[model samples]
Structure formats: structure tokens, C-alpha cells
Target: MSHGPFQAQPTTKAALENVAGQLRQVLGLEKVDFFPVVKVLEFGLPSIFENFVFRVKEGPAMGDQHGLTFPDDSEIWLRDDVYEGVTQGKGRDRFTAAHEIGHLLLHSQRFLSRRMGDQPIRTNCDPEWQANCFGGCLLMPAILVKTCKYIDEVMDRFGVSRDAARHRTKQLNLSMQEVF
Candidate 1:
């Protein structure tokens, strides 16, 4: 029995950490360093793009779709609302961009490989979940998350939203006993 489209493997914690570590090393980021989004997008993505052009397009209303990554052309499209949020320093927008980047890093190769064959492409695992997990890992690395005393600290240090920090704290099995 032949499996239909090549299902991309779900990323593990170790895999996420490895990727995060590589990104940190490439960017010269320390444990508590906040990711410089523009630098990462402009400089870091180029290293992965090879000959493909990496561009960010600010489009009209995307409704709930904050960002999208098209690996075929190495492009990321961000909704106007999302772009505004990024300029205003909203953490959700940052996470959304990072999530798109996550898709480029984690799914692009699998998508390319699937297209090479005659199989109808399908995802066995939820790509959104994988990308979301990757976004969390990338923005709030375990090294810093482990040292945080409160969710607010994670939010402040990583520039992540309260929800993101809370979820990450839960993932790390950290208690949210403090009032703050």
C-alpha cells in the first residue's frame, strides 16, 4: 500500500530546540536575547533562500489570516492589520511572522520533496500546530523560559503575548502562582 502525499514529520521538542539553537548561533543571540525580527527576516532568511527571492508583502484585509508563507517563491505575505501590529510592537504579529518562518523552515523541504513525486500532497500532521510550536520555541527558547520566574517575565523578555507566554509556561510545566 502506497501512502498518499508524503506527510511531513511532526517536529519534536528536540528538533525545535536544535533549530532555535542554530538560529541563535547564526544571529549571535544569547539566552535572554530578544529576537531582532527585521534582522532575522532580512539577513537570516537570505541564507536559507539560496537563489529564491524572499519578500514580505503587505496586503489588504486577510480576515483571520495574519500571515502566510509561500515556499514556492520564498515569500511571506502579511495582512495589513498584522503589519500594523508589528509596527506597534504587538507580540501576536511577531509570533505570526515567526510562525510563517517556521513553515518555511520546517515544511518547505517536505513540500518540495512531495511535489517531486506523483503523490497527491497531503499533511498527516497539522502544519499549523507544528508551526505554532516552532514559533513558541523560536521566540521563547527553553533556555530563557526555564529561568523565568513568571509568565509576565517571559512575555517581557521575549516580547510575546500573555497567551503565548502562558502556553509556553504550561508546556514547560512551570507554575503560575505569582499574582503578577
Candidate 2:
């Protein structure tokens, strides 16, 4: 279960933006069109999810487990509630889905390259943190966030939760006093 050194580097804002920008180009997305995240995940990156299985099965309680990706075949299993929430346009669900996608993009290579055994492999870097950072940057790009007049606008435009929008604004150190 030792993980390989695939980008086994610390997560940086620059790296996250680079990946998000690449994804935006691949999905033909504009900076203002963050609402179409689910569509991009379903259509733009079909190859990643198409070749493998994606099951929405019952699992841990909400907030406990959002999604799981099988390294052996790149299969993704999401909790039924979370899946329903995502389809229903819940902000938390959208973030969770993007978070799982982050793992796929950021950590799948290492998972695929390494051999799995009973013991779990520990790495110096935290993949979960990296994926979370990716998800945030993907959903709320710094360029777009900087243009937002208020945090509410970011939430409304991006379909992200209030907390997420606020956190992103704080992360980018964007002033919320002016309105555009």
C-alpha cells in the first residue's frame, strides 16, 4: 500500500491555479461560469469516469464520507445522500464532488503506480489537503473571485455555499467593501 512519488510535493496555490486553469481550458469554461461544474465533471472529463465504474451506494452518514475512489481500476463510489445532494445542486455536494475529482487528478497517478498491501502507505504530504485546495481553487478561481463585488456574488455565481465563498474570499484576501 505504499504510495509512489507522483507530485509528492507540497500543495501550492500556484499549482492549484495551474491545474484549475488547465481544466477550464479543457472544459471550455469561462471564469464566470462556475455553475456548470457538474456538467464539466460529467461531460468534460468523461474519460476519467467513463472507463471506470461510479456507484452511488449507501455509506457513512452525511459529512462522514463524501466519496471514494478505487485505485486499482479508478472506480469512484459516492454516498447515496451525497449523490442526491449533488444532483439537487447542493453546494456541499458540489464541493465534495469536486474534491473527489481533485483526488483523481492529483493522487491517482501515485495510487496507480504503487502496489497495495495490508499496511497503508503514509506519505509526507497530505493528499486530502491537496484535494481540498484543488477543489476550492477549481470552484473559485482567484481571478474570478477577485472580480466579485461581494462574497454573496461569488456564492451566487459559483453555486458554492456561503461558507465556501467566504472562505475563498478570505483565502484570496479580497476586499468586500466595494460593489461592482
Worst 10 residues of 1 by lDDT: 1-10
Model 2: lDDT equals 0.69
Q: What is candidate 2's CA lDDT for residue 125?
A: 53
RMSD of each: 5.1, 5.1
**Who wins the TM-score comparison?**
1
Q: Give the per-residue lDDT of model 1 (tens digit) for 1-180.
A: 013343566557667768867777776775644777656776777875775444545564455567777666677767777766766668999898788877777776544334356654443345666678778888988887888787788888898899999998888888864446
Question: Please, what is the whole-model Cα lDDT of each candidate in the order they appear?
Answer: 0.71, 0.69
Candidate 2: which pairs clash? 1-117
* TM match of model 1 to true structure: 0.79
